[model samples]
Target chain A: MKQARDSAPAERALFYTPESVAIDYERDLGDPGSYPHTRGTRPPNTRRETEGHDFLVRELSGEGPPSRSNEQFHYLLEHGATGLDVIGDTPTQCFMDPDHPYAQHAVGNQGVSICRGSDFVALYEGIPLDRVSCDHSLPGGFAAAGLFLAAETHGHLPELLRGSAILPPLFAEDTGYSSNLPIELHMRLATDSIEFCSERMPKFHAFVEDTYYISDGSVGIVDEMALGFVELREVVRRLVARGLDVDLFAPRIALLVNCRMDFFAEIAKIRASRRIYARMMRDEFGAKDPRSLAINVAAHTSGATMTSRQIGNNIARGAIQSVALYLAGVRAMEISAFDEAIRTPSREAHIVGLGTQHVVQLESGIADVSDPLGGSWYVESLTDEIETKITDRIAEIEALGDVVELAENGYFRAIFTEAMVDRSREVVDGTRPVVGVNINEIPPERDTLLRDLLENRIAPCYDRIEEIAAWRASRDMGPVVTALDNLERLCRDGSNIMPGIVEAMRSEASMGESIGVLRECYGRPYDPMGCVERPR
Target chain B: MTPTTRLRVLITVLGLDQHEAGALAVSRLLRDGGAEVIYAGRFQLPETIATTAIDEDVDVVGISAHSWEVLHYAEELALRLGQADPPIPIVVGGSVITAADQVEILSKGIDATVLPTAPEEEIIATFYRLAEARRPRL
Candidate 1:
């Protein structure tokens, strides 16, 4: 007989009853779409009736060239996917062009290689911008500039665009997402996009604080939500200080949360997040609009929990995690494919991942009602517990001084490193039961089928060096140089950099050139990696 | 052949693959296992990693890969490290690493590979064996 575990991953009590769980329905657990929305942000059945489905099924699809990613977007749309979650390759995310020395081997390994507005043009060639909701996973200012330019090229006004842009967090350097850029400049670029979009693009989410990477570092559920709120508060403070009304942009701000494998804990964390955001927005910021008080949550399944061993087990894990998201009332979600642990999803694996969402939406009956586990003693108790813990954790983080200072001083890295080591130790010692990794016993020789699957796995392969070179040569240098010079002027003068970025894109300046100019103005090397020097 | 010296190892992630949880954890694991770990951190190029390994006089180098960049950079990294006076062995590991990836890495002159699922004892033992093979015989 095996010994039973009694605590959740967050170290909270596993079981609850009315005696342990105290709830005042009128105050703590109000009706759906009500103030301080503990139940949900939307009215019951809003997803099924108002929204296209119970929830928008958006699978993250991006790999190789823009043309290939465009094909993937159409494929997902044709196969019941309601939205597109586009991600960029690592080099693009780091503001490196294909020809950079550091970007040589990593041109288009994981996600799509997008360097300029032209790449976005190829990415969304035939997909109408207004008809679909596309979420871009890229750095803030660059994503906005590229999309705006693409919309202009396609004759679609920016105001009519339906999508969201990721606002890179202050700790982007610590996370290694964009280490080549200085942190202050990164935040300025993020704010520039938010300020630009607040006046325009009402339909687009101007600021999406993605906590997926943070949580994936093995940070506990409580700290994940807490850190997310702290980052949100910081961004909100920056925008408000810029004299922008909270209502002007608050309604469009959102969070990209991570749905980990903890069934009840994940659900409770998300539900608690809604209540926290509602109270924080109303009480702290003095926001007047009801829409501004409610926080929009889009979730991505935790890729950290997926394992390379027993590859098929990930499908089961993904399905169970998706249930947690639906129960928590996520507006949109992307489930990780079964083979995501080994490589980027193959076409079949991507479709199977999409199929998982469809089955849950149509067959599971779990999405039929809103917050179906609302009044359950265990769930309600857990929600209250997580809510209080997250609030306390936020204060603890704030006590460490400014979030940017903490990030620059290596505070986030230290915590993340400790958390990661502790988690790895647990798995190594069998305290954490990862089925294929530590708990179950299987010899390598007997797992030949999985080996075969791994052997046939396809990674995106592309050589964008010559293509980008050709693109550069084809464009006239006169406007490009002028645009880059103007961008530098704006950077030095402390003006909003979005218009300059937009103008640079209009002149067909590549992302590397524009960012290189900004880098130079900031008194840093043109390439943070020290690979490329500015041309005379 | 039980030579007595604390083994020195260089741990790093090549290129823009920034998933550092595994790499950081392995650094701690090696340190705990009595090895002197020189953690090179993230975004390391092949030439830089090779120079650091030789500069630090490490017995073996470990590349913690969470993406397919390991496959693309493996040959070049092997070539760079091979030019040292006494070539340093390279070991690779990650959650994304599969048996096929291990075979591919081995063919590129990498000495060994460890999966995240490997027990701590197995991981430590593999690194020690690789380090021992690279040691100078008296």
Candidate 2:
């Protein structure tokens, strides 16, 4: 059988030698947690005191309404999940209410639908806010506002809150997966959350630069790192320009990267990413705090690599990717479920996915040491090569223009589209050997059982339109209107919109209504889909 | 269909599902196969898709349904497109699409369903065949 020996995406050298590496330990491999944290973020013995596991096994779990997803949260916790990663449904992520005309079909389809602060309250009904680390993967000011209001309702102060919020990326509008708010207004709203969290949420990560979107959009590993670092730098520049110290918000900044099938390259890319980030922070921003120099890297197994043809093969893929992530010394990890390529994972598949992490962490003993593959000749050489490639790629990306200009001019989209086409062509031409897809073949009828298992695992649909209507009827319109008016004024006056958003949520305003005000202030349609007109 | 007369196809994604790789890939494949591709991008409503197809006078409309939104909106989209004078043929494809989903969508009047693992040649051929079938009715 013919096989491609080159590393994917970047097509780096397949083999390396000591002469090729020539890595100086003192210069390249500093002690863990020291300046230029290339080996790992923390020392080997610096595991979390509470849990024996070295890394936090945070599984992505959210579907249906807040109440339903809340059950999954508790289920995951009971099953030994160290943290919670909550995802919002399409409607909620886009800041549209379930009642919106364009949002009806997608309500509660992909993730939990949280249309209001109360929904967040219900989502974490009995879960203690301060005790568990949550990744609020929803991007926007509304998600942060809802979460903040929920924490307050549960008697937790902003300072006591734990977890992270995914700030909206500049390429969000270009990708079409997130809100369609203009890039400038979107960044403004995101900056508001960063500012709010930097001041109050001491233990919370204000911005998690998720390169998973870029990689899953068919971008190469080198480009993914380049784009991620570029976006992170732009965010840092904006925050610093606001008169905030580099050390203040930089410590809270983190990355969520994708773990693809190229095991060694993925590991090298992650190691290089840490080194690049540390250098950028210390050299570029002049950060003094050690915490600001170290970056927290959370990885998710690439969902794009999961094949719909041979569903069970994805389990092995996830396990192998988990091992790569562990060897690379990721702080937190989430394995993609085998059924993810088909639909939202079933409970059985979700548990198995969680078990994959546990098996690797506890059973395999790979986590006993930090950066176990740190000094290997091949890994070190590849890491150096990747580091150089990513630096050059970043320079090329910077030369194109700023993040916002690249986003508006469709530069990222063009590259991603080209990559996607090339990938498909590779599969078609047999250059890429996807086991069940292009290489080893299987008849469709033979996989009926697997198909049944994945297809039958459909998330139950909740009538959120009626639920929102009833909740709206139960709330007072007076406070809601006042809060929305205040939020609009804050948007117009160039003030942080987080406080106003929190006020609206506290007043029981829906996310759509709150975002509608921001959209109107920014001169866009009240509805991102242009389905509804702004009220005069 | 004559070789000189290029087949026009509109590629789009409906609802809030933002995974556009499949849609974009199909657009590229169709364009490479000598079809006049009208890429509609994302965040499109079913009504808007039908209007775009009719307005562009495309023979076939390809939807990249990467989520269950297609299951919910397929009937409506098919109905809207069916109301056209020469109803457009709709093809849905995505990684998330299952054989059962293909059956369900086909039952809803979708003209064809292509799996993500389908060969580029087969996919291009399917779209061209759908376009050829629609031309005679036109």
DockQ of all predictions against the true structure, Cα-based = 0.68, 0.70
Return the lDDT, model 1, position B60. 88
Task: Report the lDDT tens digits of candidate 1 across residue range B34-112.
Answer: 8889999887988999999998888889989887788888988999998886888888988778767788888998888
Docking class for candidate 1: medium
lDDT of 2 by residue, B11-119 (tens): 9988888888788778888887788999998788888999898888888999997878888889989999888877888898888787778899999989899876677
Report the TM-score of chain B alone for all candidates.
0.92, 0.93
Fraction of true inter-chain Cα contacts (below 8 Å) kept per model? Answer: 0.81, 0.83
Give the true-structure RMSD of model 2.
2.9
Residue pairs clashing in model 2 are none
lDDT per residue, candidate 2, A319-391, as tens digits? 9999999898889999998888888877888898889988888877788777889888888988888898889
Q: Tell me how many clashing residue pairs each candidate has.
A: 0, 0
- Model 1 has an lDDT value of 0.81
Error of 2 at A457 (Å): 4.5
